[model samples]
Target: MAEPREIPEGPAHERVTVVLITWQRREEALVAVRRLLELPERPRVIVLDNASTDGTAQALREAHPRDSAGGRRLDVVVLPENQGAVARNTGVASATTPYVAFCDDDTWWDPGSLERAADLFDADERIAVLTARILVEPGGVEDGIVTELRESPVQGAPGLPGPALGSFLAGASVVRRSAFLQVGGFSRRLWLGGEEELLAADLAAAGWELCYVEDLQIHHQASVLRESTRRRRNGIRNTLWFTWLRRPLPAATRRTRDLLRSLPPDRTSALGVLDAVAGLPWLVRERKVLPPHAEARFAALEESQRTSKSRNYSR
Candidate 1:
């Protein structure tokens, strides 16, 4: 772990910007924005509305028109169309801050987490992203994914703030702006579900590290309004796509077979497989296996991933 910094005595607005991307769920998103604006960090926030027909853009704009001093408390960018996770790319591009904390409409950072994340980034240049501990709301219990992140089998560089990680959950992580841009942000081809894997791999390959910091925290309330079936389908499909795009032939083939074998016999699982097959041409064209070091990091996680309840493709 790195030594803590104690010279700060102010809001974290200048060093970190919160990026929230939402689609369709106007009410939930509005509530999220309001809660975020009330955070003590007072970080500038950018909300990306994915061309929602439910007037999410108008609602967010109306709810947070301006701050107490009439400065822009929130910047809402309404996309021309739904861009899935890609909406975050635009939000991050608009931020002037060096660090961008990716917050889903259903989640928000703890008051001091963003500030601490900025400190962690300042302490280590190799750290590309630091994923926070997530406590599911209503009871504030640890999320299942936290266990996987904490017990990650992949080793990280010594002196990192926490355990090293192969990938991060975007909604609960803070990323260095430069490293993220260097790798082209989130993948358009991946769109939304399970999209962080590819970006994490690219960051690792580019000599950046992703870590899971146990002390930094975020809160989440699973949105009932989310499209579960589509999320599952995309998560499954993207898993296949990423595996094929970066893993050697044998690992890719084994991963695909193992994934398919584990999936429930349902329409959603079938559609996910079909979608991955549909992208065969693109996958083949873009296939570039990671270098030995980066490849080894991901390979180390196969054992844990196979047994992870959090990684399961189910509602």
Candidate 2:
């Protein structure tokens, strides 16, 4: 690991604050915080420790005992219980900066990338979300989803950094704090896996632009301690709820059928479907179809989503 360097206090450094959520991953979270503090931008960081029994909160406090070199504080909020992805909502609420970048326990933004992201937000007032090119750690290879983001079929409007996107990767994205709050953060109902899609859709519906910026980078070292099967289950259930909540009747039906067809014949898939069915009443009550333009963008991505290797539910 590189030694922590002093960061200059400036407008760029003050533009964004990072919000990371972790559960039980104490060592990984500490390592991530160290790398984040070492960034040249030296943005403020807040870690939401979701009631980890592993002393993650204590480790984080010990790791960042003082403010960053840029004079921004590293704060930690230890929740009473595991709120899953909703823990990010608390972190975002605590942020004083205009932009909030989401990070997982196993991920960290690259040096200067937060500043670059802030520049993009400064350039475009309508850009609510800016997703970075994620490079997996160790080999530093581009994430499989990076290809999908790069080849996004959505047409980009003038002045945006890269292609337009209908959805964003929360762990690798920076968002306007106000816009994020206005539309609400991640859904508590969706929990963690694949939670970004619902929030992204709501942002789009409110006329906020989401874009992919290749220059901004994030490093993700996927943690070994993960509940893959449970994650896949939640992801599938969330997808179903999102489809029913936002897509038109025909589109929703078609998507649900397609998803069912694609899922492997297993107990997990069956349980995911059952869980989705159990939520139908609530989903119906909250369902609001996307506008024509936003729906069209989602429609354009169906084929790509179906073919995406990164989105597979197989654990």
Q: Pick the candidate with the highest lDDT.
A: 1
- Runs of candidate 2 with Cα error greater than 4 angstroms are 1-10, 67-72
Q: Compute the lDDT for candidate 1.
A: 0.89
Listed in order, each prediction's TM-score against the native is 0.95, 0.94
Per-residue lDDT for 190 in model 1?
96
Q: Model 2 reaches what TM-score against the true structure? A: 0.94
lDDT by residue for model 2 (57-144), tens: 8877876676456443688899999999999999989988888999999999988888888877776777889999999989899998
lDDT score for residue 277 of model 1: 94
Off by over 4 Å in 1: 1-11, 67-70
Candidate 1 TM-score to native: 0.95
